[model samples]
Target chain A: MYGESKSGMQCAEFDLLMTDAIDGLLTGDQLSRFEQHKTACPTCSAMFAEAEAGLHWLGQLEEVDPPVNLARNIVLATSGLANEGARASLRSVVNTTPGRPLWDRMRDAFSPRTIWDHVRGTARAIFSPMATPRFAMSAGMAFFSLSMVFTVSGVKISDLRNLDLTPRNLTRTYYATEARAVKYYENIRLVYEIESRVRELRRAASTSSVEPEQENKQKNKQDQKSPKENEQRQYQNFSRQDSASVVIATFDPGESVIGESARQRRKL
Target chain B: MEDAQVVELLVRRCIAGDAAAWEEIVQRFNRRIYNICYRFAGSPTDAEDLTQDVFIKVYRTMASYDGERASFNTWITTVTRNLLVDHFRKTKNDRITDSIDAAPGESEDALPLSDRLEDTGPAPDAHLERRETRELVQAALQKLSPELREAVILRDLQDMDYKEIAQALRVPEGTVKSRINRGRAELARLLQRTYRQVM
Candidate 1:
């Protein structure tokens, strides 16, 4: 009903009122207003019709005959839950009920003990060396956090291999400024790498010049078909011999086995 | 015995740890709860699982039930609806990936309650149209947002009056009314789009 009335209602409001009217929810003044509005407005009339049709369509949706075994399956699945509840009230009249079950009392007697045992077992296993899932998760998280802390401290995990971890060195490391120690380690490591490279190059030069006869003998013993392949093999042998350095930093007792991959990268 | 009296007796027995009484309670509400779960889940397997879980939860929380607060039906509806809301939340991502055409298996059991209700009465083309409309309506119902869909299901499909819906949803009567109105309009639009071709 689009008629200009003394009390002007918005189109949305009228539409909503029409919905209520269709449901027979609008009574008295509300119903009176909606009837007047819909007669005047074709849109409102359509709205009422649409609402009515929708409700009709929905109403046509009937109570489906439930699946045949649904109740049985539910009863089976929820029996344990029901028993849990039953256990709480078992001291009361349920104990007198016919067909009183055994599992309920068994569960009541042992469940807390079992649950407590599990909790205690979990607590004991968490920090132990034998890896449980929860323990592994914690260990992994600890490793990640420690790695992040080491990275932020400018002490890469690889750097621990180079630091001398003796009592005297440990004290120096403990007392040293973090930035100063890191800078010193970086420069000294660079110098060590250069010296190692120089030593390898000198060894290569001496071998080629001084051991020409020996090189020839080796070449004769090995395959001499490809000059390119021979050269590549010589370079690879030199690299493998010098790649990994055992810097052996004792900053952390746990990192004793790790070699300096940083120094290894410069070997090529 | 009236449903209320039966419910009261069952609740008392269930609380008293009477397993038989609990089974009887499950028998009473299983069908009603399954239908509600089916409306929300859109698949029989999921509906059955949800229904089982819902009853389990109801049994666990049976001790807290206060008849003064709400009738057993209203209280149980609230519990079922809350569980559905939580389930929808958990499965929202997975549900988004599913195609609209990937409708669940439409076994006789999976069909809308209306289809089954009218099966005995309708004849020929009327039966076919009703079946078709029922399927379309169900699909459309699934398309609505959870709030709107629940409101429509409770108010229109389940024939719950506004007061019951408000009590079940824990919303004000006015909010329930508006949600029903919006849901109906959306459902109508969906049906109109679908029926434009068939009708």
Candidate 2:
């Protein structure tokens, strides 16, 4: 009880109202009583004045701005605790499951509640940033595109489950791959042969047409030669042409034999 | 929603293991807590460390919070105060009680605290630079006992009301007021005796 004494406002009463007086909260009768007490008592008056000055100095002591990393450090520290707490809680839950038959416990392990909790936790941990609707939609579209590719590639999920990895099957697969590669190489070689033959025929026709006089001279020389020698010369010329075609096919299969022949004819 | 309701929801979210909610709580209160620590510990580095320790304690014990009993602000202030008191107890023996006659920088030729001050009471119009006043006040505040120091800090510097300060200190309202009165008187005396001109 801080009632006024017979002495009229003791030091205790003055101390009681000091804060309110300094804050200007005292008014009317209380204000009058406080002012009278302050004037009547030197100790109370000095204490009151000093308190006001103390408040003034405190007002000057501005709030010290925290370091810039304070909030970040706090968050990092607490978030680590939160994660540990979550893990601890999970362990507690798992540990507290009532003892039961292994089979029953196993069944309960797959229970919807347990599964849902695990799924929710995993989602929070792994996909928290991807929880947006836009991200979900993008994820769904990507899954659908992957499914389409699998279907087009004839890759059934069942087929994946039943894949044949036996040695015999592996051997068959290896031979099949080898056969396919050989067939591809043969096709390329056939194309090269056809192109080279066409170029040779075109060159032969062009040479005869462009230099008939030279061809006639060659024919006369052939006529003058013995038949056996002429046959030997023809065989030698055929062998040289065959060797050139083989060299072109081996060294640069993609080079155009027709372009080469045209350049050769121009030089001749 | 009102601010009280918003804070209540945040508390619920934090209890539900929402890290972002906890982060928001830290963002809202870190500066206040740091300032309280700064006033009590008398150094920024110590204040920073104590602020972190306070939050860590709060985080671990958040489940014990009862909203119906007190606001988050009061509870956090209580946590910060408790941590500061604990730290003081730990480092109490290490603190050097400098003699009043000791010179600045401990040099013999330098002026003592009492000799360096201007011989005048603080004028209503007397204006010390903000930084100078802050340094003078902080020095005076550090001279008070922990009990009195905390009272004035929460009351005047922190702007907490009597009820909030009482709750944070776990003391009666009357005791809070009495300590605040004594604390302020002592602080004023310290400042007036030493840095009288800067008041």
CAPRI-style quality class for the chain A–B interface of candidate 1: acceptable
Please provide, for model 1 over A109-172, each residue's C-alpha lDDT reduced to its tens digit, 9 standing for 90 to 100.
4576445544554555453454558878888999999989988989876876887979998777
- Going through the candidates in order, the fraction of native interface contacts each one reproduces equals 0.48, 0.73
After superposition, the stretches of candidate 2 with alpha carbons farther than 4 Å from their true spots are A1-7, A84-268, B99-128, B196-199
Considering the true interface contacts (CA pairs under 8 Å between chains A and B), give the fraction that model 1 also has: 0.48
Candidate 1 wrongly placed segments (more than 4 Å): A1-20, A25-28, A41-44, A84-86, A89-268, B96-105, B108-124, B197-199
lDDT for each residue of candidate 1 in B29-117, tens digit (9 for 90 to 100): 88888888888777778888898889988977777676667888888999999999999999998874233333533453454433333
C-alpha local distance difference test of each model: 0.72, 0.79
Give the CA lDDT, 0 to 100, for residue B6 in model 1.
80
Worst 10 residues of 2 chain A by lDDT: A87-96
